[model samples]
Target: MNMNESFQTLNFLPRGKFKVELVPGVSKTNFLSICYGALTTIGLLTFISYSTNYVLLENLAYERSQIGTIVGNLQVIAEIVLLSIFLPIGLIADKIGRRQVYSFGMLTMGLAYFLYPLATGIAELTVYRVIYAIGMGTATGMLGTVTADYPQNHTRGKMIAVTGILNATGVIIVSLFFARLPKTFADMGFDQITAGKYSMWIVAATCVITAVVVALGLQKGTPTEEQKKIPYLKQIKAGLAEGRKPRIQLVYASAFVARADLVIIGTFLVLWGTMAGKDMGMTTAEAQSAARIVFVTSSMSALVASPIIGYLIDKVDRIKAVSFCMAIAAAGYLSMFFINDVLSPDVKPLFVLLGVGHQCAFFAATTLLGQEAPKMKRGAIVGVFNLAGAAGILISTGIGGKIYDVIGPYAPFVLIGFCNIAVSLFAIYVSKTSPDVKEA
Candidate 1:
């Protein structure tokens, strides 16, 4: 069968069908460079993320604390909005040209981050973030499509996994080094808050420069008939069905659940730590510093694990990897419930477990999602996966926060621990059987 017809069989979204400009054995250096650029954006995000709820701390709480909730809400709300928006963006990339979409996304990141210093409250911050989310949705959908544009899957996974390591690199950079930039500026008599803002401005500048390099250096591919043969709307019906396979669905579900666990940590675990220990002798910053240690350590481990996981994903059973990851994470989370000395100087080991457990799940989930999603409908598949994961964040935030408020600070950790264990079992049971879909 021809490439067009094979794509027709994989029908993703009615409008999402775009032709692959990738001639078999095409050079991947361009794609690799672009992925590296995207990783820089990830690093930029890691740095600004610490500022997301900065105002909510007891210290920053008085600095217009109400805006904290609003800023936090922007991320959740944007995730939902992106669900609807990126579906078409993916299809558009398929139809118009992916280079257009990719460049636009970087520009959005540049612009969004540039505006960070000016945002003073929920309303202004929300506007800037929504733009960032739109950029994110575009990048999320396009990266897999761009990778598949290559002829090989293994090579594709390797390149993509490199980006994952870059993500870990970004996290470690901001957590370990960005935290200290403030003091450097303070030595020159700058206010701590002003110095922090300068750090964000630097991240913004990096994104802007990356966007420029991509816009100028990257070549654009012509649109193809892979999607032109089908109407955009009717295509989703065919796409989801064509794309659906039993084992893939189970794997897909594993990503959905695993990412949900991750989103929970990204959204609320740090907040939970500070709130939980107000009377236990640790200040919010101290709790955050301790948690940052976990993130830094895990980010370091991811540097090593990413390529290996990428290698194993295609060769070994993807589900088995997912199951093993969930089991370890479950053990780590459960350990929190039983350990009494969470704040002891010796509690540092738990951070390593938290890091390893979470990073393993992250590496596995992204590898699986990209591997399993059909080229034609990657946008919708990613959208659905993201939708489910976003809901995970929403629920974790709402439920975890409420539990902490009603039960005590320690309640959320206990909840997370039990959840990791339970979800691991569910994922394993699902993976035991084969997915009904055959490999394309």
Candidate 2:
């Protein structure tokens, strides 16, 4: 099918469909990249639902106030582990093919999911989560690199938009199935814990299959421009130096906001919605289904928003694009402040706004990072991007959890709103002062 025809069939918004230069020739690599994007999102969404649900279950099993403490510690532990290994994973991927690292990361992630339901206490869960973070951290870095690697400059935006659509679709599908799976199973005969475990095992099995597919389907490519002639420390020093560029700094900052955007919604929104539902006298299963609907709404918005945002990234000044998106995100989060009820009908528009903002910022940030980073050092640079993201998730979850318990259920969203505004201002400053880097 022609590009225009495909866009027509997808029925994108009138403003979204645009004339573009298309790349010729399709290959296994392109298909593998799409599959990897979709699979990654599925894995991520399932894990997120599992973690948040586990936190809610723990609150009931233990003390409610510990909600903040447990979730905070889990995130802090996982981020710390990710921070430690991310650079090393990138360095290793640079040495070997990205396919090997990608496959290994997927395997490790599957093992971690397999172990999640076996945890008897917070300590055990923490241990498994740290293990899970390694896989997550590695896969996250390579996904960006691989996506950057696959498409020509003219087609890169379209490729990214397609990946984003697939990812949002994956999240929607997983959330639809597994978000209520425990409750669905409970209705049949299984206990809550058993049902949760069954759902988790399904994710684990899928992760293993994804890993095998990646190993078999992806072709080997030389990732680095040259073999490292420098010592490890010097290469590390060089990668660190690259982060100091003005545009690169902005991308790093965007990483902070983008990751925080994701972690907040995934961690807090589910908790808030579920807790509110439970307070409304809903059963655990019913509460979870209700809570998960928020993500469904958000993902649906992102699925539609992706192509438009991707097109803009290719056409506009990237920093300005990022600033605009962040501003929109800030407004979305601000909408939460006036929301008295988590289950209110008014909430969906706010989430839709949030979803669009996050997806746009995600595309803008990663595209800028991919375009600006030195090709030889791209893997390590993307690692730095993921590292900043890890820090954001750590800070957002760790501090936001406390705010949820201490200030109010909605206070975390308010804080995130302010953070978004702050970053948007920074983006504006970068756009004005720095020379624009063309994507090609």
Candidate 3:
């Protein structure tokens, strides 16, 4: 279907009301799958981004620099765990079905979250983080591949944007309700550890609920007859062979940068903002609130930007579109350099800019991968896609954590900003040299 028709028929909005529309040719089955995917995305991302970043990690280490290092280490370890299992899980999903792998990951996550509050120190926390990473490894790989499975090529970006919206909404919901729940418990005279654990248990419950929904609601697709004929090893070899192409190379590059964007922001941004608030004489509760505001502002901005960016992805060249988004992200991260206080009004614009920029890059990259990778081998390709992302998280956060402590609070952002600019230029070069762009 055409873009205009896709928009008009996707939803049943009254007159000019703003509401999300379904993509064209969406069956009741496809619609249910999308809805369940959104719901699952909401639960998982909320736990990963909001509950953990905004709430749990902050209290783990008292020293600001120590917290930075610890958070960085957590990411490093988790990504390593994710990297180890991602390819195998992808292969398994392709061999059997995505639904089982996807739902099983959620179950792993729920178990990990339940253990999070039980940790007595950094070492125990690291163990829990690894468990969570295992879940993340399996679930995230499937989520991307399955999402690509559902959308028509023309509407892939829009479908991704809808999930992005759900992700943002998840962040907002957890930020508003769960991020503050610990503080609420503290206000009621609970001890710090108790208050935090209670909040985490709530997230754990959500994970369980989401897992059940996914296991029941998500459907398995019949592999194409051609796909059925290929050996698993041949599929793996083909997926790796595609990596030598310039477009696939670019997508890998995008994965490295894009995966770390939110992680750095979610983990360190909270660390900086909360520490800054404490420096300004705010209590722990107040500081956390300030950090939540930062998280919420960025999420809300991304929420607003997702659909618009999705539309742009449909109309523009994916390479050029990603380059533009990277440019915006670079500008946003660079602007943060000038803000002396994390809570300053000056930071909101930067948050919005970063949000829009990052989300755009995210969808553009996903859409490109969806377009470029053959359907039969998509799960394997997406496995590699996530491996690159995991590596990005590992390298950037590992160095960024140290950078946060050694160079300055703004150092990590500065480093990533430069990387974004460099990548943006690389994308332009690819656009100039690459032909048959639509195939990618």
Candidate 4:
């Protein structure tokens, strides 16, 4: 059968109103698989931050004071690895296929997880983290590339919103269930070490299964005739040159702060809550559970707000939408200064705000990038975008971790908050001076 016939056969699939007008050759089946991949890949990646703390305290016997520095260093290492390879990975995806790269990434993550629980020291753990970073950069790079590839220009914001909702859902499920597995096993009469090992093994298995799904479910081969005709190095140069556009510069800036926001919440927020729970005389398992509650609150808020933010993105000038999103993010992250206790019920509202802001900023950045990136050079352009994000992670985690240990846990959030405000102002400037040209 022809591609049209295959798509017609799958027409009964439901993707809601927002998913209308897919680009040619992208069926509802491909869209569904993309959504599921979003759910699992991000869910598993975010859970790593939460679970790493458990391993440090329970399995490695690290002190609370040292944990911040160690986690920071580990993230720095991962980002460094990502910095080196994100562009090449994107070029490879453009040449071979997104599914092959994406599938291999998932399988690599599974390998890292299988080795994670077997670490006897920080050195071993650090090595495993580098392996994990390779998978993360590969999978997430494809995620961004495909997200941009699947939709017509008009439906871009809604597609991003759907994926954003699934991303939040993944985080919630992983935090609530997968993150809690170690504690559950401990409660079931396993030792701390054994529980952590078993939990990681289960996640490792899940990653392998997800790899299989991605390999089979996603659309096969390169995306466009134009891409195939271009020489490889010229594609790289074209992607880099596109950054000269003011709107593209704004998207890159948004990516920097937006990525940092995610890592801060995943790393510092949970660490703060976990430490607070321990101070109250809770066991490591109990403390982790409490931290997960706070983490879940933020993810739940993101889930609720995604469709609304997405709708607004589709309706407004995307640059203006980015400014609005950064404004909300500024408000949320700056609000962290007011919270004296992360574990208190009164702080739930603040966490909710953080969630909404985080989701909005990410959706805004991604949607804007989707709108601006050229179709033929989309993968390479997305790599640069992710490279900017990697730089953000490097700085935020490298410095934020130190300040989190020295100044206060609230310091990291406040630092990124000011960044959000700065980007918001920049977005406003770009909107006035360099508005997007109307698409023909």
The numbered model that scores best in lDDT is 4
lDDT of 2 by residue, 71-158 (tens): 7677788889988888887777777767788878778888887888788877787788888888877777777777766566655666
lDDT, candidate 1, 31-76, per-residue tens: 4455566566555555445555443343234333233244345556
Q: Look at candidate 4 and tell me the lDDT of residue 89.
A: 92
Error of model 4, residue 13, in angstroms: 13
Worst 10 residues of 4 by lDDT: 1-10
lDDT of 3 at 133: 89
Q: How accurate is candidate 3 locally (lDDT)?
A: 0.75
Evaluate model 4: give its lDDT. Answer: 0.88
Clashing pairs in 4: none
Ordered list by lDDT, greatest first = 4, 3, 2, 1
TM-score for candidate 4, please give it. Answer: 0.96
Candidate 2 achieves a global lDDT of 0.73
**Candidate 4: tens digits of C-alpha lDDT, residues 1-440:** 12245452222235444443577788767877888899899889887886689889987999989988888899999999999989999999998889999999999999998899888999999999999999989999988888888878887888788789899999999989988887899999999888888988899899888888888888888897557677879989998998998988998999999988999999999899999999999988889888999999999999999988988899999999999999999999999999999999999999999999999999999999988888887888899999999999999999998998898999999999999999999999999999855341
- Clashes (candidate 3): 1
Off by over 4 Å in 1: 1-28, 55-60, 63-74, 147-151, 154-157, 216-219, 222-225, 242-244, 269-291, 336-345, 404-423, 426-437
Alpha-carbon runs more than 4 Å astray in model 4:
1-17, 438-440
- Model 2 spans > 4 angstroms off: 1-26, 42-46, 55-60, 224-231, 438-440
TM-score between model 3 and native:
0.91
On TM-score, the leading prediction is 4
Q: Which stretches of candidate 3 lie over 4 Å from their true place?
A: 1-9, 12-26, 39-43, 46-61, 225-229, 438-440
